[model samples]
Target: MSLIAWSLPKKTQLPAVSLLGNLFVLWFAPYAFVAMSISACLVYLISHAKSQKGHWVLLGVGYCISQFLLLRFLQEHSVDLGLGGSFSVLGVAYFTCRDVHYLVESYKGNVRKNIVTFWYYQSFLPVMIAGPINRYHEFEREIQRRSLDFDQISKGIERIIYGYAKVTVLGNYLIEHKIQSYLTQLPNQESILHSWLVSLADWAYLYAQFSGWSDVAIGFSLCIGIKVSENFNRPLSSKSLVDFWKRWHISLSSWCKDYVFTPALLITRNLFIAISLSMVTMGLWHESSLYYIFWGIYHAIGITLCRLYMKQDNEIVEYLRQRFWWSSFTRALTIFYLINASVFIGLFYDGLY
Candidate 1:
């Protein structure tokens, strides 16, 4: 930690503080949630939440209920009926719902895509924190016929090392300077400048913090008999919001697009209502905060605008691509910008409630 900070000039080291602060947060945030999750797990064992997806659902619902009870005993109220605990419950529930819906869609036929067992799925430890959020089908084929070449091994290890460095080293600054008591002293209503800075740090923190874990998970899975999906691509290298979505936190975005956006759109051609409702639903899923709700609408509005505007010109993306300088520049800035916005959205993650 000191070595990397020493490499940078003195002034640049402030972010280092925020990174470190976030590291501590990451380290300690899960104890309460994990205990609740385990209790949920036991309930699942005793009850009949039999399928892998079913286990996730039961676990999620039970965990939330358990958390509610605990908080209530402490004389605290839930932020919503479902929040003030790990966000993973929502994620697990969503995946379970997706799995069940998929099975129903397939009419109980050959719906077996990912053959990896539930034990392999949930028991994998890395994803329990932040997530790449893999789908069940992603593992279906690979688990059945998995192999790693020499190149794969080398690359995987590199990814893991890089990821750890990102979280521990890069994320250190964000945690130390930002996530700790420093930011809490600031007013909630921040200026555009502070918001923007927070935005950048937030993204950097998430990247180093999350992708770092993801890389470790993916690499470890590669080492073991199990394998998992990649969560991020060169997301910061996206040219536009659409491209950014395509690259960043792919599993969550794709799941949202598939289950939320498409279904909402198909239900009606009313773009405004459909998109707004979808974003609101997405918001509620995360932590049921007004901030997240607004955050959802904000992105949905921006994305919808991008989609509408893009359709206006036949040569927009193609033209941008040919103008290599513009494309690359935009992509780079955008990656930072989107993550920055993400951080602002994540403001609520600071345990405000």
Candidate 2:
């Protein structure tokens, strides 16, 4: 069935088939259906509202509330706040992003308003769970331009294989098992190498897991004749923290830049505060905890410092460049800083501290 679908060029068949398959999977949790339905309805209303500015504000507030509730649920694990009993909304966080994109674009009169297309874009099963969060405009364009070319199909297949390998092999083995075990013994072992090893493994593990999910989502989207966003591109090779974010989680980072950072910067007229707020929002999106909060603040400071450093005079930059090992040294330092930060995130996630 999958092989035949891969070979076929019928655009309509894929959505029908994919939608039905996702519906079947969604049936396992009826509450998820209700949640998505409610979310979709709200999004539709926001998209079509007469007072779009007010509606957008209302939608934004609702979005934050939903995230807070979900975060609370994840933390407590046994609390019920009426959306669903003690279960995370399957794709609530991702959908919130899509919802925000739809609302903001529609309000700005930038997106063509189509109820049918909006529903399809919002609920597209492949990218729903873990997204390279597709924009409505881009998604619509891809759908219009979709073709079942051999190159696209082959690329999709290769991405799927690579993504599967990343998740199952590198993520599962190197980090989840081996490195995880090593970290658990770090305190007792009392070795700097062990600490560094844990941090390094965690940084790699996070990239492998999240980027693997992104690859799988992108690969499936491509197979179905859509070109969703790419989420990562050699983030570890980044020369600076600012550049690292540009390459990592491309979807979310771009989303925040467009929807949060830019607007906040305009409103507050303060780059530092705007950048800090963006980082904080990104961190909280992961989970609501002191650890995640600190993670966000930490990145914000890193980025702010980088920005300040770059503002130095041209002479200073030229002098620094004169040193033969300056480039290599800076690159290694950036990686080291990221790894150091990620160690805390890993420990937090694993409940090690």
Candidate 3:
């Protein structure tokens, strides 16, 4: 294979790392990760995939495939895997395509400038993974996005450190001490609360792992040259389950709202029917799994109830807000309710398989 030396001004370029840098940080072997990233990126490019949801599904599948090949088929000698190496393959492939999508949106009217500058911004690595799901129009403004200012830097570092501490300390304790033992021990079918208590640790562990990484990514983006979208908020603070969803995985919620819910709602005047269809769409979108269906149903019921409850006389939402002051007691109660409900739903349906 021939490699070409790229020449571009640092000012004009989107902030991303080199192939060699990707190799160093992101793959089982630099070569292997590079190959996987190339293949995955090619897959999206050739497919001309438009939606972020599609990209996420494809990336998840690609990661699974690469892991199977590297860990199952190939020996350790065949590849030395680092977390970034595997993550990079999935991450780079995703962001590369998203940047392209955003650029296309950015240059809706100017075809000439759009084509010329498309590749430059698209290949920038910062926005490529765990994205804000850019629309090309907005990205035109940030073509040569710069590093954070002092205030941004300070806040970003604090957020990153907080994220790291959450994952490393609290998240680690749950995983290493609680989750492991619980997973090995068979569920006591007699008392559901036993299962609920154990699984809550797993959920917290998952949140810490993912949120911690997301914070680090956000901090890294600021340290470099671009500001990406926020991923999560304090979801458990939600008054209702629907509100909880809005706070929790913002990207996925938005995707579902935009692509599935709104479209379905538009098609029919019947609220129940629209919701029913929306939930089914969400289930299939999550991958055609039984568990996803259950989750979708759970969400549909929750959303529907929330809507219906709001329409009733003396709305529960207004009552709750007016009744309870936002205090540690209320917040803890909200957390308790959400976690307890989620635990049963989670165990009742573990994996798609």
- Give a tens-digit lDDT track for model 1, residues 96-172: 43343343333333344322244344433444445566655565555556543556666667777887887787787
Query: Native-vs-model 3 lDDT?
Result: 0.54
Find the candidate with the highest lDDT and give its number. 2
TM-score of 3: 0.64
In candidate 3, where is summed lDDT lowest over 10 consecutive residues? 1-10
Maximum-TM-score candidate: 2
Query: What is candidate 3's lDDT per residue for 1-353, written digit by digit as tens?
Result: 00111134554333234443354435334443455455545534433435435455445445534543443333424344553333323443244334333323322332234433344444434444444454444445554445336676667678778878877876787685766675658666547767566656666787787677677767655654456667788775666656666777675566556545665678876676667666665464434445656666666776787678657766665666565464455566556655655664666766533
Q: Of models 1 and 3, which has the larger lDDT?
A: 1
lDDT score at residue 345, model 1, on the 0-100 scale: 59
Tens-digit lDDT string for candidate 2 (1-353)? 24545555665565574576458437654555666667678777777877677657565647745754665465457555576544545666777788777777877788887876776786688788886888889988887886667788779879988998899899998789887886887674556567777778777888899999899888877777688878998998888899999999999999999988999999999988999989988987787666777788888989999888878878879899678688778789888888778665656657855
Report every candidate's CA lDDT: 0.56, 0.77, 0.54
Steric overlap count per candidate = 26, 0, 10
Q: Any residue pairs clashing in model 3, and if so which?
A: 26-84, 26-85, 27-85, 28-80, 28-81, 95-128, 102-136, 105-137, 106-136, 106-137
Off-target runs (Cα >4 Å) in candidate 2 are 1-18, 21-25, 55-57, 60-76, 80-86, 182-188, 322-324, 342-353
